[model samples]
Target: MVSRAHPHGDDDIRLLGDDSFEQSDEKDNLISFDDTSGLRHRGPSSSHKKPLSAARSVSPSSAQDSPKGPVVAVFVVVFDAKQGNRIEWSHTVDGSVDIGGVEYKALPSGAHTVSSDSLTFKIGSYYGVAYFRTETDKSSARGAVFRSCGLLGRRLEDIVGFRTVLQSELSQGKHSTGDYHVLEDLVGGRSDFVDNAFTPVMERVNKSEIELMHDNKIVRDFCTLLGADIFRLWKCVLLRKRILILGTPPFADLCHIAHLCSLIGNYDISSPLRPDYNLLLYVDLNDIDKLRQSKTFVACTSELIYQLKNDCYDVLIMKNQLHIQDPALQRTCLTSAMEKENFSELMHDYNLRSSIMHVDSGRFDATEFVGGYFTALNEKILSAFHAADCTAEQTIADSALEDLSLNPASDVPFLQALANMHCPSIRVQRQPLCPQCHLC
Candidate 1:
């Protein structure tokens, strides 16, 4: 017969041994019943059959006696973008369960079911589940099954959109080739028959050959325009086409020349061209004192100027008091010089104002320094326009032209008008202009 002992004040009951069944402990409260034959006894009647083992006993602790439920194993999948694949699933549990022949312990007791899609687990008794999605599956297919379960609305789509946009923007533009019709006209003294003179000699020059030829032409023109003798030396150094400048030595001016070459080459006038030619500058000299305070300063500048000339660059040297006669050419050089300084504070504060004032005051021809500075400024202006964004190019060109216009002695107001209509500007300058056309 099954015997149960009740806790004095608790709902739980303890099962006692057959000997203890006859006497109730003060801590236990026992109730005895008669056998089915109807014979009464102090304990369970001997005639009554014992309860089946599974149901015979009750423990004082309900936790020990209650039937434990099945545990559900949950797998949470995570998509890994860097690896371009789906990573392994993370497992959780509603209760303990065996997975892949290994026992997982201490899961919350509940009815459990493995996910047919293999990426989820449902704890039926607890009404809980876990799920995840993979990156590849999310990208290629709209959605895929995970252990027979639908995996939808499980991943982020914004990242894909951003990447697509970025790639499209990066691959949209073409390379630059320096080609400017106006500059060619100015240099050759007439626009009537110059196109044929600059036409490609070969039907299709390879990219490298085109670059080399363009670089050589840029150096030659720059030196000649500056009235320097560097172009002759450049012809001699055909074997060493590349030139490296060790000090600052006005890099912005060279970049301007490069931009002019691009214009002449008919590069996309609307976009900034990536630099293709190599011109390395080393600014990190180990000796700080050797920079501007040494006797080597003047020597270094002279040597650099000589080398630049030898390399076929138009290297014009000016005493602080030199001047020039042609107003148009002077204006162009002034713009180029401004560009060479990369629009630095020094250019804006001193060179640009001084050049403009000299040209306006009709004092440019009085000093070689004024003439040289003007030439450099013109080159710098052209390069800046080339580097500006599509929308800002026209605006910047107009502003530059206006600056030139303020100087009555300057002679390129018509060209400035054309620039204002067609050129692009730096992207940052795309905000709407004021009624006065001022960039607000």
Candidate 2:
């Protein structure tokens, strides 16, 4: 999606500069946005009363049940022509955790001078969701606008819900030291600032409470966009190869793809090959230095600058196509006959549920399916290695393989390669049934 005011159509675009900043008159009256509806409501002091159901408190039990609730911090980041992205103002839940470090992830890398975009990215242990907005500063000498800021939290949806309300407040010129108390309260697990409409349903994904909640549409779109290549991409992430995702503005989808890619490995495993979600929502030339030095990470960029940098990443995914620098990694996309059959079966089941089961039934979740596939795959590979003891003569029992959606012929060779890469001390003999020639 393009920015409402600054639409980016060109491959190469310029960004706003420091000359664009001219202090504008601040409006005293604050307007609060209704999260449930797009309508605007009077500020908190308005005598108008909301419905009883409209103003439910965020009880302590609700906050305790899931630690992901309440945002961590809110930041106002602005891009300077001279210094690049910088934080303008920030407020934390408890006034702890340094918000200055978030300067990089707060705005898209190589963002246009006047475009707007939203992204979700990881900063250390916290996840940040940001809305980048740029408007024409008519009073400025350059007529350029500046502002790209974010909301931080443990839950993606929660931060997003608050982003709408916060953006509304910012647009109204209510950005004062005192104006941030509502934001601080929201981050502190107080939802009284906004109505019940603002609350996002904190539903736990089936099978695991630890797994972060994801939008079905986002997962489905990513899977549909990649089609069969999703398997190859999954393997790339599983191997923790450096991956770069290039996309256009309103990089919300790309951010989701990067996030889902980051979840490839089992959390319990502490191997070097495990993929870490180093999700850089947007990147430009400034970010290239760090991206080059980084290990096994998945990052997204809207800047065309990366198109020239082939040496930096092992895999590049753009425009629904997956590209790999190494032919060996690319060849993994070729599926064996057994592997094809297994994928077909998984697809059939997925399609059946999509068509037969109603979405409201909650039985059909693409993220769950994809997540479960990887979880099972990780378990099977880990279990197989333990059972076989990395011996060339021992064959895995068919019963053990039955639990996996992938056939033995597909996972066995790949597992061996991964084992050899991560655990160099143990020579993982290839499973005889895999027949490497089939993959090549």
- Tens-place lDDT digits, model 2, residues 14-51: 34333322221222101111122111111111111111
RMSD of each: 41.9, 12.8
Clash totals, every prediction: 60, 3
TM-score of each: 0.17, 0.65
Over 1-440, each residue of candidate 1 has an lDDT whose tens digit, in order, gives: 11111112112211111221122232221111112111100111111111110012223352232222111222222222222112132222222332221101111001011111111111112212122111224543334222110111111110111112112221231101222222123121132321232211121222243433333333333333323212111211111122222222122222323223222212122323322222211111121233323221111121222322332222222321113223542332233232223223322333344356557853211112222333333334445555453342334433444343222222233234323433422321222334562211
Candidate 2, residue 383: CA error in Å? 1.9
Name the 10 consecutive residues with the lowest summed lDDT in model 2.
37-46
Top-TM-score structure, candidate number: 2
lDDT of every predicted structure (CA atoms) = 0.24, 0.55
Candidate 1 TM-score to native: 0.17
